[model samples]
Target: MNPLTAIRMEALLSGRSDQLGPDVAERLSNHPLDSIDTEFPHYARSVDSPDGIERPTERHPVFFGCYDWHSSVHSHWALIRQLRLFDEHPARSDIVDRIDDRFTAENIAREVEHFEDNETFEKPYGWAWFLHLVSELCLWEDDRAAAWRSILKPLEETIVTLIKSEFLPQKRPFRVGTHQNSAFALHCILDYARTLSNERLESAVTDTATAFYAEDRNYPVEYEPLGWDFLSPSLTEADLMRRVYSRNEFTMWIEQFLPDVTTAPYDTILEPVHTNPNRDEGVALHLVGLNLSKAWCLAGLASTLKDHQYVEAFERSAKQHMECGLDRAFTDEYAGSHWLSSFVLYLLTRNEGGIAPE
Candidate 1:
């Protein structure tokens, strides 16, 4: 019947469905639905002047929950993804209603105004996720998706314009393992660009990635997973470059860049970092995300280099990291719960080849 429903049915009939059964889908979907509208415990990153403080909902009508702005945006993305993959989910009506309440044209315009006012507010991370949300809406064939896409067009245009004028022109790429990491943002932006058929933005991302990382060598893999880190800078760069280069070219580049991926010091990148589930510090929860992100990146590398010498290593590490990451993804801790589901959803989808490619 429905496209998503049809896909799920086909998978079931063919016995091709993986671990993302209806129960796990419901669990993952429920987290974002519960937090997307919750007001308290917000982490505002606004640059408000004295006497200008406002509630998160007051500042961001559409994306005011999920601890922070980017988390809220990607939480929305995760919800839409769940709805897309599981057509008969128990929370289907709730998902539709929440998205309907949030995707109003007026609300989106306010979001645009906020973005214009705070140009560098979310920078590469949140901006990339916002574009990704729009991209997801663009990909769905549902009527509601079309309406939401239309409402989001202005904000999408604003971000696309900003990237063309401001972000792409930057000479240096942030190689950190956190939100500021340029490769992660570029990878997401490139996906959005390709999804929307925005060749100019695609070219800009390709050129910028090349300029920033094309000649990279000896990535010092052992020095990664810095405290409070969620992404692997070297693997993220490799993931982005795989999108930029053809199979042959990327093979050559990765061989040089991570020459010792199968050896000591470098192989350490494969081990998932330990995350304390009962930790009090919010930032300590980043290790959970690090495991998930590493799984995602490693899986991508393994898929791309299926015939390469290090493909087995990549595959083994991806599986180990994914298992470790999933163990911590459903934590009761607010620090992990508010945002970790999105990473979980992403990793699961990537494993199933549901996400779009470059």
Candidate 2:
């Protein structure tokens, strides 16, 4: 097993946004920094893989880079967020210009058409990211963003209907750390729902979450990161529950679902994961994401249960997980760098009311 990167704890725990600003800017600034732009890694079922596929750029007009479709979508979310939060930063004007040019109605219409006849296009993962992109646009103070949001609303309604009808009622959670992970998707969409006051969307997510996870108890907790994992199954569940339940209910729930977050074993979820991308280049990069995402989840969880005995433990563990990967993730192998910054900004610039937009 590869040892953790061993970065200083302070780097992750610090309050200064400027510390990671340059890294965030760089990740979104370049022109499709990885080969996915060239190789076009569109994952498709055999039934859907027809004889001749158009190139990635031709297929995905609005989001055709950053390694994969979902990564490209969230990169857009991150760039919009960075521009809004760091308004006076030097890169702001250029970012504004870049977005203005790309977010045109024609490009957005092409993006909408890309979903034609594809039933499982993006599913909840990519669906959630698209909503996240819209969520940022909702809060952004620019006419260009307003125009883009107008063009994007039809697609948004399409996802909201799909989730309510198909995705949520499956009544099964994808208990993994990757794209299919239900908790991660629900977490992002739920936040988007609350921010936009979409009561229907919010109800669909909370209902599914309660049905899927309300009774989960004594999660294996130890058997996570199964080789190619990227999110903490049990921890992500706990994080989402915080949003669904009141303080007292969530505290009671966490005590049983993960009884060791603060004591004895102190929970294996807290330990920094180690990875050697050289061994399995693609799978190993997930460890970096697992660490950053786990950190944000921990931070969000701790905020809700402030008076619990394990609050400090959650906060400390969050920093440790972040220290393990936040800085290193930026310039690490392309497998990780092309997309990790979106999660980085989402966590670091997180507002007080949990994951809801600032």
Candidate 3:
């Protein structure tokens, strides 16, 4: 049954700033800086690289940390977001210094070279986070923001073009709720597109959303959240649909998509996912993300639908998910630590369709 039916407002986060307590700010401030330059313990797609490809740092100038390309980009997004939200976040000045060092014209140019070598390097996932970084920068409109925007233009343009022409056309929805998940990536892309008022990018994402998900009914939620998943294929799709359809239309569509969600008390899917944290492997730590991701999805859906049926249960479920994953996010496991806080920030901020900036 849909646990979102009874979600409440009290359980919803008051704001993203609440998650950045002194300790949390310190933790976030240091996490990415510690590894933004370290190269190993990373994953890269060599298929797109030369036979003797360089290490992660050598290949990706700016985004070489946090286990993989997308992680690094999202980490950067998290860093900037944290700094923007809190003026006195102990590490604010240092973050600006670090950003200046990494987001230089020469460095971004090298990153563009890498992208040229591998046109579909990160496909839509990394592309989305890159856009997320750009979107965050767009919120600034400072001289530094303008410089960074211009410097990253080539790479940004390529990604936007691919989403409209190449990626969207060839794409079939990936419902796995992982890096390959189309809904999650498209969700990010759509958010970025809307913020910039890029009709081309916005139209492509909206059309793709309609084509891929509009016709779906009786979605198979029972098989959801595969063991290694950090995303909820069902919920992420529902969240995306919320943006694509109007309130009346989305309400109608969501009820069909998750009929079980209409059930009272909404307890069937409320339990936090269990994982064997003793294992430090990346696969084992995804449960933390699963919980946080669900929290944001529930919160996002409730805000979008604005229906009484969900205000209570959705908020409670989101709070529970955040509680389950909060401590686990700051872990010793690089597999989890490097990435989990970013997800936490995303949920905590609840930056729905660009409202945070305004």
In candidate 1, which residue ranges exceed 4 Å CA deviation?
1-19, 46-49, 279-281, 351-358
Candidate 2, residue 235: the lDDT equals: 84
TM-score of each: 0.92, 0.87, 0.89
Residue-level lDDT tens digits of model 2 in 1-358: 1122332455535433554555445554443333224334454334446768676677776677766788888877877777666656556666666566666667777777766556578887998888888888887777877887887776677777777766888858899878888988898889888888888878888998999999998887777766667788888888889989988999899888885755546477678787664574665778888888888888878878988888888888888788776645665556666777677776666662325432
Model 3: per-residue Cα lDDT over 15-41, one tens digit each: 446534555666765667665655678
Q: Which segments of candidate 2 are over 4 A away from where they belong? A: 1-50, 262-266, 277-280, 352-354
Candidate 2: RMSD over Cα atoms? 3.8
lDDT of 1: 0.81
Residue 123, model 3: Cα distance from true site in angstroms: 0.8
lDDT of 1 at 150: 88
Where is the poorest 10-residue window by lDDT in model 2? 1-10
How far is each candidate from the true structure, as Cα RMSD in Å? 4.5, 3.8, 4.7
C-alpha lDDT of candidate 3 relative to the true structure? 0.75
lDDT of 1 at 302: 81
Winner of 1 and 3 under lDDT:
1
Winning candidate number (TM-score): 1
Candidate 1 per-residue lDDT over residues 1-358, each given as its tens digit: 1112223322322212254567777888777998898887987654558787988887888999998899999999989877767777878899999989988888988889998997887888998898878878877789988988888889889988887777889989998999899999898899888888889888989999999999999888899877689999999999899999999999999988985877786789989997665553577889889988888788888878878888888878887787777777787668788899899888767633225365
